[model samples]
Target: MTKTLPLRSYQFFLSIIFLLFSAPLLAQDEGEEEKPKLTLGGALRFNYNLSSWKDGQKDRGGDFGYDMFRINAVGTYKNIFLNVEYRLYSEAFGGGFLKQGWMGYKFNEEDQIQVGLTQVPFGLQQYNSHNWFFNLTYYVGLEDDHDMGIKYIHDSERIQYQLAFFKNAEELQFGSTSEIDPSRYSYDIAGRNKEINQFNGKFIYKLGKDRNHQLGTSVQYGGIYNLDTKETGDHHGFAFHYEYLGEKWNVKAQGMIVDHNPITPDTISDNVLQFGAYGGTYGVAADFNLYSLAVSRSIPVEIGPISNLEFYNDFGFMDKAEDDFEDSFMNVTGVLITAGKVYTYIDYAAGYNHSWLGGNYVDDFSAGNPDAKWEARFNINIGYYF
Candidate 1:
C-alpha cells in the first residue's frame, strides 16, 4: 500500500511552517518580543559493520555506510512552541524521511497539548540500548515509534502522563528498495489498511527520596484493516517499564504484550508478518511478548580527549505467538565514550535463533546444530550533536 499523509497531518505541518517563518512579521506590537526564541540542533551519525554468518556466508557480508543525518529547529514564543526535525539522508530509507514536526502550547506547567507528527509513547521511550541498532523491538515497530496525532501531557513532581490519538503511524514517504527495506521499520500493522487509527496512554511515577527511580505503564488500542481482503482487525497492547538512573550506574527494562486479532481468518499473509514485525514469518492474529534490559556505568578511566567512558550490556528477547516460529534474542556488550557533543560506540553483538537484525527466526539455527545457532557482528558508530 502506498503511504500518504492525511489531510490533518498536512495541515498541521503547513500551519506550523507558516507560523514559524511569519511569526516576527505578525508581531506588530513594538514592546512585545518581535523575534521568537529559536534553537537549532542536529546530529550526524556514521556506522561501520563487520558481520559474519554461522555458515561463513559471504552475501551481504560487511560494509561501511552512512547511518543518518538529521536537523532540528525549535521556535518558542511565550507558551507557544514549534519543533521540526528532518532527516537529510539515510541509506535505508534513501534520500530522507520526515521524523517529526510538531507545534504545541503550554497552558501551564501541568498541562500542554501538541499536534502533528510525534512519538507514540509506548514501551520504552527509545528502546533499551546504547548502540546504533537499538533493540529488536525497534525493528518490530515498538521503539522510536512516531505518528501523526495530538497528545495531551500532564506533568507534576510525582506523576507524568500522556494521552494521545494518532493516525497513519510511522508513515513512510520515500518507499523502500530490495537492498534496504524501510518497511521493516515502518509502523504499518499487518492486515491493516484503512485509517489505522491508534489511541495510546502512558503514565510514569518518580519514586525514592532522590526521585531517581521511575516506573511507567503504557496502553494502546487501534483498528486494523486488510488491504487485500478488505477485512478488519483489532490491535491492543500493554507495557510496563522501570528505570533507575544513578550517578555511577543506570539500568532500565520494559516488557510488553500485544494481541492482533483479525475478523477474517484468511485475510492476512502467513508468509510475511505484517509490517515486518518478523522477518519472513507470519503472525496474523496472535499474541506476542517483547522484552528488553540494559545496564551501563561510567568509569573514571579516560582515553585521549574522551573524558567520559561507559561500559554497557543490552539484552532483548521476543516470544512469538506461534511455536512454529522459534523465539529470537540478542546480547550486545559495548563501550560508549563521550567527549563534548561527540559520542562513540564500539560494540559486539550476538544473536541466537535469529539474524543480527532480529526480525525472524533463522532456519540454519536448527535444534541440533551448535554452529548454526549463533551469528555475530562488530560495529563502530560515531555521532556528533550540534
Candidate 2:
C-alpha cells in the first residue's frame, strides 16, 4: 500500500511547454484544434518519517514508510472537465492493498459536479490529504473525499463558493429508512459515504487591485438522518490573507476564525456539549529574487474537555488541561490561548523550538492560566514554485 504524493517535474515541465505551445493551437480556429481533448499526467511521491511521535508511534507499521503512489488522468471539453485518480493506500488502510479509481467532474470551472469518490476540498492544507511528503503534515477538520456524492461549486476568477449535497461516497446511497446506514457509519462512518446527504458552502473574496490580498469564508449546514435518529449541526469558518509585494521584500499575514456548533461531529446530539473555538493564523515570507522563504502559522481552537466524537466512540484526547494537562479535555474558560499550551507542553518535555531565519513564533497565553492553550503550527515551505 502506498500513501505518498508523487512529484510531477516532467508533467509540470510539459504543462509549461503545452501552455506555450497552445498559443499556436488556439490561433488555428479558436475551437478547431479540439483543445487536445485529453491530457496525460501522473506523479511519483514518497515519504520517510523522522519523528518520535506526533500522534503516537509510527513504528507500529515501521520506523520509515513510503506507502502512497497516485496515477491520474485529466480531460477537458468546453466547460466540462473530468479528473480520475487512482490510489494505493498503505497497510494502514487495508493491509497493503490497492484502492484507486476515483473520478470527478467540474462544470464552469467553479462548480464541480463529481461522481464516485474524491478529495473533500474544504481547507487550505486538507486538500493535500494524499501524503507523498512524510514530515509534519497538517490535517484539517473535514471528512475524507473517497465517499460517493454529487457536489455543486460556485467559483470564478477571484471569488469562489462551494455548495455540495451528497450522501456517503464509498457505499451505495441508502433509502431514507435504511438501518444499515447508521450501523455501518457507527464503526467507520464511511458506510454513509455520501450516504448522509449534506449541504456545504465555501466562498473566497479577493481584494486589492493587484489581487495580492483576499478574504475567504466557509460555512456548512446539514443534518444526518440515519435509520435510528436525525443528527444535525452547523459549521462556520472565516479566513483572510493579505500580502504586500515588493522588488526585494515581501510581507504577508493570513488567519482564520473557526466556530462550530456542537464542536464534535460524531454526536451532534449533546446539546450542552456545544463548542466554540477561534485562533489567529499568520506568517511571513521574504526573498532576494531567486531565493525566498515563507513561514505561516495556524492555531485552531481545540479547547474543550469533551473529546470530539469519532465515528461511534471517543477515540481521541483533549490536550487543554490545567493540573494534569496529560488528559485532553475542553478548555473550561473557552478562551483563546495560542501559545500557553505549547509552552507548558514544551516545558513538560524540557525541549525548545527557537526562532531562526527571521522566524519568530509566539503562543497566545495568559499568566498562570495553565489550561489556556492553542494549537499553533508554524511551517515554512521554502522551495521554488517553478
Candidate 3:
C-alpha cells in the first residue's frame, strides 16, 4: 500500500499503539514471583544445488539454471523474537518470495525494539549467523531482506547500537531480475508494487587496550516507491562499515551505496537497470580448538577463498549485504561447524565487487553464458537440543 503521502503516517500509527499495548505485556505477571521467564527454541535447515546452463551460454557454473531449495526457522524469548523462512530457489527469480518472516522487541540490557519481516543489516555475519541460504552474497544470511517496520538496539560491554524501519523486503535484492552476473552486471530492481520504505543505523566501538579488538559503524536509509514518481520518487540506500571482533581472531570490513530512481516500477526498468554502486571488503576468521577438534578459515574480499577443516567442538559465522536484480555489489558468507551436536558444517557465497572484485565470483552473469562460472554451496546438518 505505497501510493503517495503518509510519509511515516504518524509513526505508522504510533507503532500500532505499541503493538496494541504490547499485547497485555504478553500476560503472566500476576503477583510476580519471578515467574515470567521463558525461553523456547526451534531451528531447521535444508539445502541443495545443481548447476547447468545453456540458453545463451557463458556463465559456467550458475545463472539460475541449476537447482536449489531451503527451509529455516527461529524463535526466542526474554527480549522477544520469532522468525521463519523457506525457499526452493531453483535459481532465476532467485526463489520467488517463498516464506520469510520476523518479529522482535527487546529494549534493555542495552536496548532493542523490533517490527516485522527481517534481514538487510548486511554485516556482523548477517547479524549473528544463519548463512543466508548459502551465502548468496552472504552479507550474512543475506540481505535477510524482509520488511514491515521498527527496530532499535543497543548492546554493551564496550558498546554497539542499531536502528531500523521498513515496509518492503518484497524480495530484497535492490532491484529484481536476480542477476548473479548479467553479462556485464545489471540491475533494474523494481518489484514492490508499493510498500517500500526504510531506515537503518548502527555503531560499535572499543578503543583503548583490547576490548576484544573492536570498531564498527553502519547507516542505512530506504524508500523505493515510484508510483510513476508521484510516490515522490523512492529507491535509495547507503551503508558503510568497519570491523575487528576477536576471541580467537576475526576481522571484517564493509561498504555499500545505492540510489534507485527515474520512473522506477517493478519488473526491471532503467532501460535495463543500473543505478549506483560502491564496494569494499576484507575478512579473516580464525578459531581452532584441536585439543577438541575445532577448525575454521575465511578469506572474504568479495566471495572467494574459503577453507574449513573441522572435526568440531564449536564454530560460527555470518555475513550480509544484498540488493538483487543484479545491480552489482552483493554480500553473503556463512560457516558453522559444530561437533558437540552430532555433526555440522555449512557454507554459501554470492559476493563480488569487494570494491571491485577483490575475491571475484560473479563475472557478469555469464555474458549470456560464456561458459559461466561462480555458483557455490555446501551444507551438512545433524542435530539435537530440546
Candidate 4:
C-alpha cells in the first residue's frame, strides 16, 4: 500500500529549503537589526540500577555507572535560528549520536519552518512521560521521535499546528550496504525494512481560562522499503491526546493505533517488524493499539540544596492485533528532586511482556509469553545541568 512521494510535494520541499537558506541574504538587504547570539549548555548524568530480574546485581546491592553526557547549542540571527544537540553514552548504550540538529526561519511571530534532523510532530510535543524511561510509545517509535525532514509550525494564542515531510531517517553512513544500524538515539525500522518518504501533521486546541487544557490529534504515513523484496510497503498511525495543567498537578492521556505492512520475503513474518536503537535491535508488533496516561503533582520545599519535589506515575499498555500475541504493559512510579543545578529521579519501574523491562530480549514485544512474570527495576538517575 505504500506510495511514492508526489512530484509536487518533492518540489515544495526543495522550495522551502531554498527559502530557508536565502532568508539571511534577504534580511541583510533589508538592513540587519541585531547581532547573532549563540549559547552553549550541556549535562552530565549518572545512574544506579537494581533489577529484580538480575539476581547477581541484587546480591551486590546494585550497579552505578555513567549514563550520558550531552552538549547543546542554540543560536539566533534575526529571523534565522539554529538548534543542535549531541549526546555521548556508554558504548553499550549507543556510544554517541546526534539527537537533533535543525536550522529554522521565522516567517513572522506566528509561523516558522525548520529543516534538518528535527523532532517529528507526533503525539505529545516534547515527551509523553515525566520519568527517565519514557512510555511504551517511545519503544515503538511514536513518542519523541525525530527524523530528517522539513517542518512548518504555526503558533497562536489557542491553536497550534504542524506539518512535516521526512525523506527518510537519519543515515549514519551514506551509501552503506548495511540495512540496519543499532547505534542510534531514536527507534526506527532498521532491518530489511527501512522508513522513507514520511509525512506528519498535528493540530492542537487549548481551552480553559488560562489555556492550560489542550486537546490534540496527529496522523502519520510513510513508506517502508524492504531490501530483500525491493518493494515499498506502507506504515501509518493516528493518535488522540489530551493534557491538563494545574498549579500543582498535571495529567496527560493518549490513545494511538499503529499499523505496518512491510513487503518482506516469504521467510519472514509480517506480524512483527524489526526496530533498532541504543545499540540493539528487537522485534515489535506490526499492528497494535497503545494507550498511556500520566499524572504528576509538584511540591515546593526548602530542604538543604533540594528546592522542590515532583511525584509522578506513568502507565502504558499495548494490545497487539495478532490474536495469540500477548499484550505488553509498563508502569513507572517516580519522584523528581531538584537541587539547584542538580536533579535526580528515583523510580520503581515494572513491566510485563516488555523489552527493556524484562522478558526475552528480541521477542518480548513480538510473540510475548502469555505467562511472563512481572519484572521490576529500582533506578536512580542524577544529572547536573549547565
Candidate 5:
C-alpha cells in the first residue's frame, strides 16, 4: 500500500526554501564578513516511459510521471563553504527524499576537506550517460554513490586525487521494513546490514599534449553489519577510468569489480540479486564485474527551443562471480537537447540477459534454465535547472 506524503513535512520543506531565499533581504544591513554569500538552485524533472517486457506485454505509451524535484543551497564565506540539497520524489513506489548536505573548508588553492554527506569517489564519479537511468554500476551501488563521510581532495595541473572515510552509506528507503525494498535505481541494502566504516580513494592523471585526456583508478573498502546475525560482510572494490574530451567529441569508460567476502551461494534469490544490493543479491555471490562506456559528439546546429544538441551512445555489461549466472548487457542510444537551463534526453535503450537495464526483465533469472531475454524502453527525460 502507498500513502501520500505528510502535509506538515511538505509544508516544512517549502518553508525552509522560503526562509533561505528571504534571508539575504532580511540581512541586507549586515556586514560582508558576517553575511555569507548564498545561492539557491535546483532541478525539476519529468519522465515519460514506454516499456516492453520479454513476455510481449507493453506498458501504456503515455506513462507520464513527475520524476523528482531538488533544491540546493550553497553558502560561501572566505575559505568556508556549506552545501545542501533536498530532493522530493513523487509518490510511485513511495515518497523518498534527501540527497546531499555537507560543509567544507579550503586550506589553500589546491587542497580542501569536506564533512557531512557527500559523493563517494568511485568508478566514473559523475558518470557519462545522457539517459535518466544510468548504467548497471549505478544500480549495483558503484557509480554516483554517496555516503556520510569526510573527504580530502587535492587538485593540480597534472594530478587530482580524493581520500575519504565514511561512517555509513546514505539511506534511500523511507520506512522500517523487514521485507526487501527496492527503489527505482537501487535497493536498500542498509536496511538489513548497513554499510559502515567505509573508505574510498581515487587518483587521476592528465595526459596528452592537449591535456584533454585523463586516466584514473579507484579503490573502496567497507564493512556491512547484519543486524540480525550480528555478523560482518567485507566488501572490496577496484576500478579504472579513462576519458578524452576533444573540441566536439568526448569518450568515457570505466571497469570495476566489487567483491563481498563470505556470500553463500544458496542464498541467491530473485528479490536479492535484481538490484544487486550488498546483503541481498550480491550477498549470495562472491563478486561482480561491471563495465561502462559512452561516446558523444556535439552538433553545430541549433533547433528552436533547443539551443544545442548532442548525440550519444552508452554501453554497459555486468557479470556475476559464479560461473552458472549469465552475463548481462545494456545498450542505450540517446540525444541530449539543451536550451539554456532546460535540458531534455530522448533515448532508446535495450538489453539482454538482465532487466536492470529497464522494465521487468530481472524477475526471470533462475538456475535451471538459461534465461535468453530481450527488453527495451523508450524514455524521455526533461529537466529545468535553476
Candidate 6:
C-alpha cells in the first residue's frame, strides 16, 4: 500500500515550503552577497574496553579495536548552504552510512529552513549530555536523531524555536525487505514497524544574567507502519529539559515520556517495540518514562600534552509502564582530555537492564529480568580531528 501524510500535515508542510522560497527572496539584503566557501574535515577514532560480563576478555587484559572514521563537509553560497557527514565503521559495527546530509536556505539572520536528512529538533540542541555514550534517551531514538524532513528554526536573543516534519526514517533501500537493515548511525523503528509522517516541535527560553540558563520543551508525534499487517500505528513523546552553562561547570536535566502503539499481528506483543542501529536490532519497552541528569566541570591543565580536562557524571533511569517489566538504569562517570587536535574520553559506565551495558540485547528493555545484576564497562575512546 502507498503511504501518505495526514491531510493537515501535508497542507502545513506545503505552506512552509511556499514560505521557504518566497520569504527568502524578499529578505535578501541589497548589498553584494558573500562568496561561496566549502570546508572539509574528518576524524579517526579507536577504543579500548574491559567489560565485567566478559570474564575471558577481562582475564586477558582488555580488547582494543578500531571504532570508526567519518568525513564532514560544509558549504555555502549566497543564502543556500549544505552540510553533510558520512561515516565508515567496521562491518561488524554497521559498515558505512551517511550520518547526516542537508541543504538549507536562510530567510534572514534569525530564521532559516533546512531540507533533506536533518535533525528532528527535539530535546536540547546539539546534545543533551557531555559524555561519549550520551544518556538513555539516545538508546530509544530520542537523542541526536536524524530523518528525511524539513525543519524551520528561529534564533533570537532570548528565545529559540523549531518545527519539523519528517516523512520517514532514513531508507537504505527502495522497497520492503525480508529483514530490517541495521547498518546505520541513528536508532529507529526497524522491525515489522517503520516510522513515518513524524512531526516535532521544540521551544527554548534563555534567562539568567549572562543568559547562561536555558529551559526548553519538546513534543513529537508520528506514524508506525507495520509491514505485515499493512496497518499504521502511532507514537508520541514529550520532554521538558533545562541546562546551565557556568564559567567552568555545566548541568543538564530532562524528563520524558514515550509511548509506541504499533499495529502488529496478534502473535506479537504490543508491550515492546523493535529498534535497530549499529548493526543490530533489539526490543524496547513500548511505554516508559525516563529521567536524566548530568553535571560536568572543566579545568585548565598545564600537562605536557593535555591542555584541559573535563570531568562529568551522567545518570539516567527508565521506568516502564507495565507492572511486571523491570526498570532500566545507567550511569557514566568519565573525564574528557583535550590536547591539540586529539581528544580522549575515559569512562566507567554501569547499567542495569540497559542494552549496551550488561543486559541481554533482545529483552533487556522489554520484559527485563527483575533480578538482573548491574553490569559495568571501563572504556577509553581517542579521536583525532582535522
The candidate that achieves the highest TM-score relative to the unseen native structure: 4
Q: What TM-score would each prediction reach against the true structure?
A: 0.79, 0.45, 0.30, 0.97, 0.80, 0.95
Residue 165 error, candidate 5, Å: 0.6
Across residues 268-291, which tens digit of lDDT does each residue of candidate 3 receive? 344223211111112211110000
User: What lDDT would each prediction earn against the true structure?
Assistant: 0.69, 0.32, 0.40, 0.92, 0.68, 0.90
Q: How many collisions per candidate?
A: 3, 37, 54, 0, 1, 0
Residue 93 error, candidate 2, Å: 3.3
Q: Indicate whether candidate 1 or candidate 2 has the larger lDDT.
A: 1
* Candidates sorted on TM-score, descending: 4, 6, 5, 1, 2, 3
Model 5 regions lying over 4 Å from their true place: 1-34, 54-60, 171-188, 262-286, 356-369
Candidate 3: segments with Cα more than 4 A from true spot:
1-17, 20-22, 25-30, 35-143, 146-195, 198-338, 341-386
RMSD of 4: 1.3
Alpha-carbon RMSD to native, per candidate? 6.2, 17.1, 19.4, 1.3, 9.1, 2.1
Off by over 4 Å in 1: 1-34, 54-62, 90-93, 172-187, 190-195, 264-272, 276-286, 300-302, 355-372
Provide the lowest-lDDT 10-residue window in model 6: 172-181
Q: For model 3, give the RMSD to the true fold.
A: 19.4
Q: What is the C-alpha lDDT profile of model 5 across 1-386, one tens digit per residue?
A: 11223456446545544544454456455555664799999999998877775234353345777888889999997667899887777555345545678887766689877777788888776765656667666656676666777788898889999987776656545334342433323333433555657778999999988878999999988766554455566678999999888888889898888776433234533223223332234322336788889888998666676777889898887777667866677788999889989989999888776544443333422121264666788889999999
lDDT of 1 at 158: 89
Q: Considering only N, C-alpha and C atoms within 3 Å, which residue pairs clash in candidate 4?
A: none
Badly placed stretches (over 4 Å) of model 2 are: 1-36, 53-62, 95-121, 125-140, 143-147, 172-195, 225-386
Tens-digit per-residue lDDT, 1-386, candidate 4: 44576799889889888888887677675554788999999999999999988989989999999999999999998888999999999999989999899999988899999999999999987999999998888998888888999999999999999999998888776654567677888899888888989999999999999999999999999999988787889999999999998998999999999999999889989889999999999999999999999999999999999999999999999999999999999999999999999999999999999999877988899889988999999999999999
What 10-residue stretch in candidate 2 is worst by lDDT? 283-292
Model 6: CA > 4 A from native = 1-5, 21-34, 176-180
Better of 1 and 3 by TM-score: 1
* Residue-level error in angstroms, candidate 2, position 255: 6.3
